[model samples]
Target chain A: MAKNQSEVSGIFTAGSKSKPSAAKPKNPFTHPLLLGSIFPLLLVVVWEVLSRLEVFPAYQLPAPSVILGTIAGMAEDGTLWGHVFITSYRVLMGFLLGTAAAVVLGSLVGFYKHAEALFDPLIQAFRSIPSLAWVPLFILWMGIGEPSKIAMIAVGVFFPVYLNIVSGIGGVDRKLIEVGKMYGLNMFQLVRRIILPASLPSFLVGLRSGLGLGWMFVVAAELMGASQGLGYLLVVGQNTLAPETIIASIVLFAVIGKLSDWILKKLETRTLHWQDRAAKS
Target chain B: MSLQLERVGRTFAGKPAVQDVSFRAEPGEIIGLLGTSGCGKSTLLRAISGLDNAYDGVIEINGKKVNGIQKTTGFMFQEPRLLPWLNVLDNVTFGLEGNREEKQKKAGRYLESVGLAGNEILYPKQLSGGMAQRVAIARALATSPEILLLDEPFSALDAFTKMQLQDLLLEVWRSYRSTMVLVTHDVDEAAYLCDRIIVLRGQPGTVEREIAITESRPRERGSSELAAYKAEILASLDLTTETA
Candidate 1:
C-alpha cells in the first residue's frame, strides 16, 4: 500500500509538471494588436500609391490625404463635431429604448408559458421582415424628421436583443433552478438571484449584435432624410461630386462602430470573468 | 428533526417510479438509501426534499407535513451546483436570511470548518473539483438545516477524493448532528457511513431489505466487521452468490 501511494503521488507531480510546459509563452512580435493592423495599413499604402499614379479619376476615387483634408476642413468649420454628436445622440436614444422594451417583453415571454403562447408567433413573424423595409413606412407615418430616423434605428436594434433575451432566459439550466428551490427561494428571489445572472452572458452577446445593427440602420435612415446627420452628409457629398466627403463620413462611421464595440467588449470581460477563467482552465 | 414517510409514491405519465415506500428516521440518525442504478433512490430523495410536489402520500419533517420546500432541509445534488458567478464566500452565504454581517460571519465559520478558511474569495471556476465540492458542503451547512438530503453527492468524485470527503462528512455530521439521508449505489460507502442501510430494488422501486450497522465510529476501515456488512449488502444487490 505504501509503494502504491508513493507511485500515485509521483504520477500527480509529473502531471502538474507537464501542464506548465504545454502553455509556452507567446511571442511578443506576434501580439494580436500588431497583427490586426497589418492588412489595413497595407491597404492604405496601396490606395495612396494608386491615387498618386492617377489610376482612377480623383473625383471618383479620392486619395487618402484628400479625405483627411476634408476631415480637417470639416473640423475647422465645427460641422464634423455637430454631425457626429447628433448621429450619436440618435443612436444612443434608439438603442436604449429598444433594449428596454426587449428586456421587459423577453422576460415576460421567457418566464411565463401563457405569455410565450400569446406573443411568440407574432413577434417571430414580425422579426422576419427586414428592418430597412420599415424605413419607408416610418417616413410616411412619422415624417422626414429625427423621430423617423430614431424609430428606424430602434427597429434595427430590437429584434436581436429580443431574440437573444428570450433564448437566454429559456436556456438557463433547470438544475440551477432546482437548486434555488431547494434553498427555499421565493419566486421573486429565484428570478433575481438565479435566472437573471444566468442569462446575462447571452443577453450581452445580443446587445453587441444590436449595437452593430444600430450603426447600419442609422446610415440607412439618414440616406433618405432632410439634413444635419452623417447620412445626410453622405447624400450631399454624392450630389456635389465630393468623394472626399463621402469617404470621410464612411471613416467616421467605422471609428464610432469600433469604439462602441470596444466598450461593450470591455463590459463583457468584466461581467463574464468567471466564464473566461473556466474556458482557460 | 425526525422524518417520516407514509406510503409515498411518485409517477411519471402514469408509470410508477416509486410506490408504497415508507420509512422513519429518528432525529440525528445517518441513514443510507442504498441501491443499484434506476432504483428510484434519487427520486425518493427528491420527494423528501419537497422538490417534487406531484407525489402520493405524506412526508413529514418534525411532525409537520411537507407540501413544498421546507425551511428545515438542505439538499446537496450530484454536482456541486455552486452558482458559477459567485465567489466562494457569496455562494456559501446564498439563500441565507440575516443581516449582512451575520450572514458573512456564518459563512466564514462554515468555510473554516470545511478547511477552506483562506480560499473565500476564489470563484467556483478557479477551484479544483474536490475543493469546489467542499465549498458546496460549506454552503449546505451554512443554512444550519435540521435535515440534509444528499443525493449521490460523492458519486462523481474520484476514489481518493471520495474517501477524503466521506471522512469530512462524518466529521461534519458528528459536530452538527443533523438528520441525514444519503442515496448511494456503492455498498462499501453505505456500510461505512450509515447507522442503517435501506436497500431498494426493482422497477416501480420498493424497499428490498434493511440492515443495521451496530458498530460505532470511528470504525476501522477495511476491517473484517465492516467487511461483513459490505458482503451482506453485495449479496442483497445480487453481485455475489454467497449466502448471508
Candidate 2:
C-alpha cells in the first residue's frame, strides 16, 4: 500500500484541527533549544568579557574559544571520528541484533497460544534481572573484548522489545480473530493477516524502547577497557582534567541518542501510517 | 443447504448459558434468536458458529456435522473489531488466504458490493460508527459465506443508522441468499430480519417460544405482522411459560 498520508476528504474538516500554539509575545530569545544555551553563553560572555577587561584570571575558566581550539585539534587528528564511529557501530550492531532476536521470538510466542504459555514465564524470569548486573559476569565469560560489551548491550535492550511484541500480539482484538475464522482462515493466515497487523502498534512502541535502551547500554558497555569509544575518551579526558572533551562526548551522546530516537519515530510514522490516521480526528 | 442445532448447550464457569436448544434453518432463510439481556441468545449463536467449545451440541450444515468453524460460515460481531493498523480494504479482505494481489482483487469487489467503493483506504477509527459496522459486514461477505451469524451488530448505532443498515443487510441477503442466524435483544430487529424467531428465557437459558415469521419478505416496522412477532418474543420473557 502507498504510504499513509492525510486524506483530502473526511467526516469533519474543522473539528479540533489546529495545533495549540501559544499566543505569547514573539520573543526570539525564549525558544527552548536556544534557552538552554543562553545562560551558559551569558556566563562565558561575562567570563571572557571580564577577562579581556582585566577582571579575573583567564586560567581558571578557559574561554569557549580555547575549547573550540582543542575540539578542532582533536578533529584534525581524526580521534573524534574514530571514537564517535566506534561507539556508533557498537550501538548499531547491538540494537539490530537485539531487535531481530526479540521480534522473532516475541511475535512467535505471542501469536501461538502454546508458545505464549510456554515461554512467558521464562521471559518474565529473565526480565526480572537487570542488564547491568550481567556486566561483571559477561566480562568474566567473554573478557573485556567486543563480545562482552555487545552481550551487555544485547541483554540490556532485549526485554523491552520482546515484551512489547508479545503483549502487542496478545493485545490484538478477539473480534479480529473471529472475523478471520468466520472467513475460513487457516492458522498461518490468521497470524499473517490478523495477529501481526493488529499487534504492530505495541510492537513499534517496543522497538522505540529498545532503541533508547541500546543507547543507554552502549555507554555503559564501553566502560570496561575500551580504548577508542566516546565513553573511553570521556574517562581519559576526566583523568587529565580535560573537562571540554568530557562535556563534548556527553553532549554528542545526548545529540546522537536524541537523533536515533527521531529516526525511529519517523520510521514508525511512515510504516504505520494507517494507525496515525486512525488516531487523528 | 440447511443448518440443524440438536440439543445444543453451553456452560461457562459452571453456569448454564444455554441448554437443550434445538432449531433448524433452511437454505436462503434468516433465523433470529431473540431474548432478554443475559438470556444466552448470544451463547447459543456462538455454539452454532463453533466459536464456543464449552457446549454440547451437534451443529450440522447441509447434514454434515460441523466439527469446528465451517469454511462456509461468516460472523459479524457486536463490535466492528477491524484491525486498527489496516485500511478498510485490508480489514475487509483480512481472512482471504492467498497472495496479496489476489486478496486485493476479492477485497475490492466486496467493498464495492458493500457501498464502500471510494472509502477503501480509510481505517476503522476513521470511519463513522455506521461505516465501521459496514466494514464489518463487508468483511463478513468478502468470504462469500454460505451461512452468516450476527450478534447485535447494529445495536450500537443510532436509530437512523440502525434502520439504514437493516435495509442494507436485507439488500445483501436478497442478493446473496445465505442462511443467517442473528442474536438480538431488540424484538423488532428479529421480526424485521428473520424468517423464524426463537425466544430464550430462564436462569439456565432455554427456548421458551419459537415463532415462524409467515409474513411476507421486505417487512416494515409498525406493521401488524412485525408487531405481533415483537409481542410474541416479549411475552416469552414472562418466565411462567414452559420451554418450547
Candidate 3:
C-alpha cells in the first residue's frame, strides 16, 4: 500500500513540476548500474565489520581489505601482469579456434542434410559427455603444457557455439530466403546476403555463452599443472594457506570476466541496433 | 518482357494446388489474378515467378523457358519482406549490380519516387506498415525488372493506405512500363489497376473466367464502370456469401 501510494505521488509530482519542453534529466540513483551496486557494497561493509570483530576465522574468510592489500602487493611485485597476460592469451586463442571450427562445422550441418545426417548425431553424443572428461585424454595426448590447456578450453567453448550456429542457420525465415530467390541470388549469394545476417543474432549469443565456458575451462585447464595464470595463483594460495591470496585471485577473476562480457555485450548491442526489441522500461 | 504460363500445375504431397492454369501477360500490361483463399492464386503466381519450378507445365518469359529464378523478374510478397538489418537505402539496392555510388543513387531516386525520400537511413523496424511496403515497392523497381510479380502486396495495409499504394503502383507502372502480374482477392483492386482480370476457381485451381476492363487509366475509384466490373467479377465467382 505504501509503495503504491508513493508511486502515485511520484507521478503527480513529476507531472506538475517537470516541464515537458525541458526534457528533465534522469535521476542518477535510479540508474540500473548504481542500483545494482548497492547490495554488493552493503554486503562488503557488513563482512568487513564482522571480520574486524573476529566473528569468523581469518584463515578461511579474509576481510575485503586484506584481499585488496594482497592484490596491491602482487601489483608492487610486478608478477601480477604475467599471470593476467597468460590467462587472457590462453582464453583468446581458445576462443578464436573454437569459434572458427564451430562456424565451419555448424554451417555444414545447418546447410546440408547429408552433413547433418552424418555429423549431428555424433556431435550431439559428444555434447552429452562432461566437458571436463576430455581433460585426462587431452593431457595424455598433448602433455601438461599450454597446448593441452588451450585445447581443453577450446573443447569447452565449442559445443554451445556449434549448437547455436546450427540452430541459427536453420531458424532463418523462409520468406526472407524467398526474397533472395526473387532477386535471383545464386547459392553463394543467398547465403552471403540472406542466411548470414539472419543468423547473426544467434551466433553472437553463441559467442557470449562460449566465452563463459572458456573462462570456466581455463580454471580446469590450469588445474592440469600450470606455472602461471590466476588459476595457478589459486593453487599457490591454497598450498601456502594464504586466504588473502585466494580471495584476491577470485576477485580478480570476477572483475576480468565481467569486463570481457561487458565488451561482448556492447558489441551485440551495436550490431543488433536495428532489431525491434522490446523497449527497456 | 511477356510472360506465358501453359498448363502449369503444382502438387503438394500428391494433393494438387493448381492445375492446367494457362495465361499470357503482354509487355507493359497489368494483369490481376483474382480468386478466394485456397483457390491457388498464390500458387500460380509462384510458378510464373519461377520460385517454384516443380509444376507440371511450362512458364516462359519472352518465349524462353524459365528453368529457375530469372534476373528479369521482380516479386513483392504479401508482407513487406525487407531485410530488417538493412536500412531503407540498402534494402532498395539489394538486387542491383553496380558500384556502390551508382546503386545508392538509383536506390535514392526510387525511394524518392515512392515518397520515402528522407527515410534512407531508417531501418524497416522504424517504419509504419505503409512506409515499409513503400520501401518494398522501391526495392522492386530499383532492379528495373522486365516483369514484376506482386502477391497481394498491399493486402496487409489499412484501407486508406491500401488505396494510396494501389495508386502509387499505377504511377510506377506509368513510369517503368514493366509487365505486372498482381495476385489479389480484392474486387475493387482488380477493377482499379488491372487491364485484364483472370479469375481462378476450384480445389486444383484453373482459369475460370477472364474479364477485360476497357476503362482507361485514372479511372474513378467509385465510378459506375468500376462498380459494374466489380459486380460482374463477384457474380462470375458466385461469391454471394464471400467477403474479402
Candidate 4:
C-alpha cells in the first residue's frame, strides 16, 4: 500500500519535478546569419559552375566572377559607393514621408467613424491603381527630377502602411479600451497609451513591407529619369549591353534589401520582446 | 466616499438588462452584489462605475451626481487586463495622477501589499492567473480611489487561490478603509467577504433581497454563522443547500 501511494504521489509530482531551465545562449555556427547564407552560397556556386560550362551565352549571362570584377572596377572609381548612397538616401526620405502621413491619417480614420467615411473610400480607390502607373504623371507634373523620384517612392510606400495602421488600431481589444475608460483616461490619452502600443506590432509589419515597396518604386522612378543610382546603373548596363554591370547592380539591390530588412527585424525583436517572453513561458 | 444609486435601469435594444436597481453603500463598507449569470449584477456595477451612462436614474458619488467616468472610482474587470507590453510596476502605475516618483512609490507599496514585492519587474505574461489578478488589484489600489468596484474578480481562479485572494482582499479593505462594491456569483465568497450582500434574481434583474452579516471580522470560514448566511443567500437565488 505504501508503494502504491508513493507511485500515485510520484505521478502527481511529475510535472513539478521537471522544472524549465533557463534558455542557453545561441552559438555562432547555429546563428541565423550562417543558416541564412547556406542557400544563397549554394546558388552562387551553381551559377558560377554553369557559367564556366558555357550553358548559356556568356555575353548575356556573365559568370559570377565577371560580375565581381565589374563590381571591383566600380568600387575602384567610387561609382558603386555613389550609386548606393544616392539610392539609399532617396528610399529613406520617401519611406519616412509616406509612413508618417499614413500613420496620422490611418489613426484618424481608425479612431473616428466620420474620418473613416470621409477618407477610407478615397484611399482604397487610389490604392488599387498600380504604383508604376503614377511614374509618368509624376514625371510630367514634377519633372524628371529628384522630386518626381521621391514622390513615386512615397506613393508606393503609403498604401500598405495606411491599411495596416487602420486595421491594427481597429483590432485592439475592446476590453482594453474599457480598462482605459475605467481609469478615467480621456480620448487622446486612451489612444496614446492603449491603442497605439497595442497596434505597434502590426504597424511594424506595415513599415517593413512599405520599405520594400519604396525600393521597388525608386527603381522604376530612376529607370525613367536622369539619376546616379542602382536603377540608373541597370539602365546604363542595358544600353551598353554589359551583362556584368547589370548583374552587379542586381546583386547590390539584393544586398541592400537584406541589410535593411535585418535592421527592421532587429527593431521588431527589441520592441516586441514581451511577445517573445510570453511565447516562451 | 459613499455611493448612492437610485432606480438605476439599463436597456439594450429596447430590452431592459437591469431595472429599477437601488442601493446605497457607505464609506469604508464592503458590499457584494450577488446573483447568477444574466442577473444584471455586472451591468449594475458598470452603471455605478459610470461606464454605462445611458441607464435611467442617477449614480451619486460622495453626494455628486456622476455623469461620466468618475476619477474617484477604480474598477477591476473579471480578467486582469494588464497590458502585456508593460512590466508589473508599470502596469500598476498606469493611469495614476501623480508625477513619476510618487506614482512609482505608490505602485511599489501596492505591489508589496499584494504579496508581489519582488515581482515588480515581471511581465504580466510571466505571471500565473492568480498572480496576474493580484497585479490587477494592485493597479486598482495604487490609484487610491475612494471607491473600488470589482466584477467577479476571483471567479476564474482555482478554489485555493480564490480563498487566498478573498483573505487578501479583506486584509486590504481593513487597512485602506475604502468603499468597495464587489459583484460575484459565488455564495460562499459573498458571505465570507461582504459586510452586506445584495441578492438579485430573474431577468431585468432588480434587488430581490438584502442580507447584512453582523458576524465579526476574522471569522472562521466554516463557522455555523457564516454557513447560515450562505444558506440564506443560496435559498434567495433558489439554489438548495445540497447543491451549494
Candidate 5:
C-alpha cells in the first residue's frame, strides 16, 4: 500500500537486451550527445580562423567573434531580451491558437466520415497554397499589425498539427479499440481512454513540428513589417549594411529554436517512456 | 450464471465461418472449444461473448438474450492486448468500475492470484510473453464476471510457459469458478483444463463431438485419462483432411 508507484527506473529499457556480452559500461567519448557537437565545433573553429586570416570581407561576412560581439552589445543595451521576448510571444500565441483549432477539427474528421467528406478537401486545398503567398493578403486584411503576424504563424503551425492528428487517430490499432469494446466502454470512454492516449505520440510529434514552423513563420511575419523583434533586426541589419547584426539575429534564432525544441523533446521522452524502443547505440 | 448458445451461426461476406453451433455452459463449468486451425473456434467464442452480435442465433446468459458486450462477461484475446501506456496494476484495473482505492485493492489481489505480485509497477512492454498473458488473465478476472471467454490465450507462449499458465488458470478457477469457454487448438490444453471438450471441425465449423471430462479437479497433466482425451480430440481434428 505504501509503494512508490511513480518510480520508473527501467521504463525505457526493453527489447534491447539481446546481447548480454554487448552490455559494457558506456564510453563518454562514444555518447551520441557529445559526438554530435564535434562537427559543429569544428566548423565554428574553421570559420573563426578563416575570418581572422581575412579570407572573407568583414562587410559581407563577419567573423564569429564580431557576431558574438554584436549580440553581447545588444544584450548590454537591453534590446536583446525585448526582441527575443516579442518574437517568442508571437510564436507562443500562434502555436496555442493553431493547436486548439487543429485538435477540434482533426478529432472530428478522424472520428467521423461525414466530417472528413465535408471539411478535408477544403482544408487540403488550403494546405496546398504556399505559406509565403499569404503574407500580402494577411498584411492587407489585418494591416501589418500583431494580429496579422500571429495569424501568419498560426497558418504555418496549423497544417502539420492537423494532418498529424488525423493520421495519428487513423493509425490507432484496431485491436486496442476491440479491447475497449470488450470491456463494455461507451463511445466517449473509448475515445478518452484508448484513442486519445494511443494517438498521443503522433500528436506530440505534430506539436514539435508545428512549433518549428511557428518559428519560421515568425521570421516571415517580422520581415514583412515590424517595429520590434529579432526578425525586424534582420531588415535593419540589411538596410544599415551591418552583416554582424544580421548574423547575430540568425545565431539568436538558432539558439532559441534549438532550446524550444529541446524542451519539447524532453516532454516527448517523459510521456512516451512506455514505448518499446531500440537501444540508443 | 449458465450460458446457452442456440443454433449460433456467422458468415463473413456471404461465406460461412461457423454454422449451427449450439452449446450450453453450466454455472462454474470450464468448456473448451477445441479445433484445428480455421475451425471457427474463436468465431464461436466471440459470438458467445457478444462481441459479434451478427451471428445467426440467440446467445443467452442467465436466460436473458445477449445484445452486445455483456457486463457479466470477460474476454481474453490471443494477444495480451494490454494498453502499453498503463502499467501492470492499472491494466488489471482497466475494466473495473469503482472508487480508485477499491479498484486498486481488487486489482492487487487478482495480480497476486495470477502469480504476478510485486510486479505491479512494471509496464506491459517490460513483461515477457508469459508474464504479459498473466497480466491479461488478471485483468480479465478482476471484473469477476460470471462468464469468462478466452480465445487461444496460451497459443503464443512457449511450451513450458504454456503448461505453467494452464495450471495457474485451473488454480484460479478453483476459487473464482467463472464459467469459462476457452478456444484452443492445443489438444493437451483442452484435455487438461476443460470439464467438457466440444470438438469443432472443417470450414464453417460446427460441433462434431462433445467429450465429457469427469476426472474432477487437480487432474494430473500427463495422466493416461487426459492423454486419452487428447488423442480423441486429435483424431476428431484429423478427420478434417477427408471432410475438406
Candidate 6:
C-alpha cells in the first residue's frame, strides 16, 4: 500500500504544480497491490468473518493476522532472506550454466550439419527425461550436496535453450547468407554477420523458454533435501502445518518469476526494438 | 582491369545454361547484357562475380582469375537483399572491414552520401524500396571492388524510382571509376545507362550485338540521341521500333 502511494506521489510530484494538467486524471485502479492482491485480501476478510462467525473451527483456518505473525516470526529469526537468497543463487547459476552450453551447442548444431549429426541424438535422448526424475540419480552421484541441486536445475534448463538455438540457426534465411557471400564475406563473416542476426528472433525465443524452465526446475531441485531456499521453506512449512509459511514461499517464487520476466522483456525490447515494432503491425 | 570471359560456359543437369558465352567490360564503360527470358544473363553475372563456380570459364577481374576468389567484386541482385537485421548505416557499411569506430564513421559517411542522412538507426523494413536500393548500392560501393556487376538492380523498382536510381548509378560510377556491367530487359533503361550495350540475341546468351550510347549524364527522356540508341537496341532484339 505504501509502495503504491509512493509511486503515485512521485508521478504527481513531477514539475508543474500550478494549474493541474486537464488531460491527466487519477486512475481508479492504479495500485498493483489493490489490483492483484484484492482477491487474496477479500478471501482473508471472508475467512476471518466466517471463522469468527463459527463457519468452521478457529484452529482449522487461521486468520490473516496469524499468517502475518508467522511471517514476522520467520523474519525475526533471519531465516527468510537466507532461504530466498540461496534459492535465487541456485536458479541464477543453473540458468547461466544452461544458457552458456545451449548457445554454443545450439549455434553449432543449428548451423553446422556434421556437428549436429554427432550431437543431436544424445541431447534428444537426455532431454526426453524429466528434471524431477533426475533428482534420485543426481543425489546418488553428488550426495545431496549443492552439486546435485545445481545439476538438477542445469539439466532442466538446458533443453529449451538448446532446442531454441538450433531452431534459430536452422530458421535463418538462405537468401541473406547468399547476399553475404556475394558481398565477399568469408565463412566466419557469413555466420557472424548474416546467420546470427537472421536467427536472433528464434534465439531470443529460446532464451525466454529456457528462462521459464529455469524457475520451474529450481522448484523441483529445491524439493530435494536442502537447508536454504524458498522451496525449502515451503517444504519445511508443509511439515509443520503452517500453510501461511507455505503461501509466503509460493508468493516469493511467483514474485521472482514475474520480476525476472519483466527484466527479460526489457532486455529483449532493447535487443529487438526494430523487430518488435515490425511485429506490432 | 577489364572483365573478360573466353568461351565461358555452364551446364546444369546436362542442359546448357550459359553456352560458350564470351564478353568483355572495359574500364569506365557500362555494358548491358540484354537478353530475352531464360538466356542465362543472371547466371553469367554470377559467374563473373566469382559466385558461381560450376562454370567452365576464365573470368579475369582486374587481370586476376577471380572466378572463385576472395570478394574482388560486388554483385547486386534483382532484390536489394540488404540485411534486414542491420540498420541503414550498418547495411551500407556491411562490406567495409575495420574496427568498431572506423566502421561506424565510414558507414555514416556512405549513408549520408546515399541521402539517407540521419536515418542510420532505421532498419531495412523501415525504408522504402528506393531507399533500400540506395543502401544496397552503398554496400556494393563500400567494398571498393575493381568491377561492379548489377543483375537487373532496378527491375523491381517503380519507373520513377528506376529512373532516379539510374541517374544515381551514373553519379556513383563517375566518382568511383569502377568497371560496371548491368543486365536488364528494359530497352530504355539499357539505353539510358550503358556506355556500351551488349545484346544477347540468341538463347544461352552469347553476345549478339553491341550498341554504344555516347549520350551525356542526366540525359533527357525524349532526346533524339537516347531515342536512337533505344531504337538500335530494340531492332537488335528483333523488336519493332513502335515501342513508346
Highest DockQ: give the candidate number.
5
After aligning candidate 1 to the native by TM-score, how far in Å is the CA of B99 from where it should be? 1.9
Q: Model 5, range A32-77, lDDT digits (tens) per residue?
A: 8989999989999999999999999989999998999999999999
Taking chain A of model 6 alone, its TM-score versus the true chain A equals 0.79
For B1-244, candidate 2 gives per-residue lDDT tens digits of 6999999988888888888999989999899888778888888878878787668878889998876788778888998888787778888877777798998888888777667777776666567676778888988888788899999998887676687789889988888999999988887788888898888887688888788989887777889878877777777667455443
Per-residue alpha-carbon lDDT of candidate 3 for residues B143-191, written as tens digits (9 for 90 to 100): 9989999999989876877888899999999999999999999999999
For each predicted model, how many residue pairs clash, with residues at least 3 apart or on different chains? 0, 0, 0, 0, 0, 0
Q: Give interface RMSD, every candidate, in order.
A: 6.7, 8.2, 11.6, 8.6, 9.0, 15.2
lDDT of 1 by residue, B45-92 (tens): 999998999999899998888888988899999999999999889999
For model 6, the TM-score of its B chain against the native B chain is 0.93
Candidates' DockQ values? Answer: 0.42, 0.36, 0.31, 0.35, 0.47, 0.21
The CAPRI classification for model 4 reads as acceptable
Cα lDDT tens digits for candidate 6, B1-244: 5888878888888888777777778887788888787778888887877677989868776576764745657788888888876777778778778797888887776666666666676677666677778788888887776788899999877776777778878887888888888989988888888888888755555777777788877778879989888877777787443243
Clashing pairs in 6: none
Query: What's the TM-score of each model vs. the native?
Result: 0.94, 0.85, 0.94, 0.93, 0.94, 0.84
- Candidate 6, residue A225: the lDDT equals 87
Q: Which stretches of candidate 1 lie over 4 Å from their true place?
A: A1-27, A276-281, B240-244
Evaluated against the true structure, the overall lDDT of model 6 is 0.78
lDDT minimum window of 10 residues, candidate 5 chain A? A1-10
Model 5 agreement with the true structure over B73-170: per-residue lDDT tens digits: 99999999999999999999999999999999999999888877778877776777777888999999999989999999998877777877899988
Give candidate 3's error at residue B176 in angstroms.
0.9
**Candidate 5 runs further than 4 Å off:** A1-26, A31-33
Instruction: Candidate 5: give its CA RMSD in angstroms.
Output: 4.6
Q: How do these models rank on DockQ, best leading? A: 5, 1, 2, 4, 3, 6
What does each candidate score in C-alpha RMSD?
3.8, 5.5, 6.1, 4.6, 4.6, 8.5
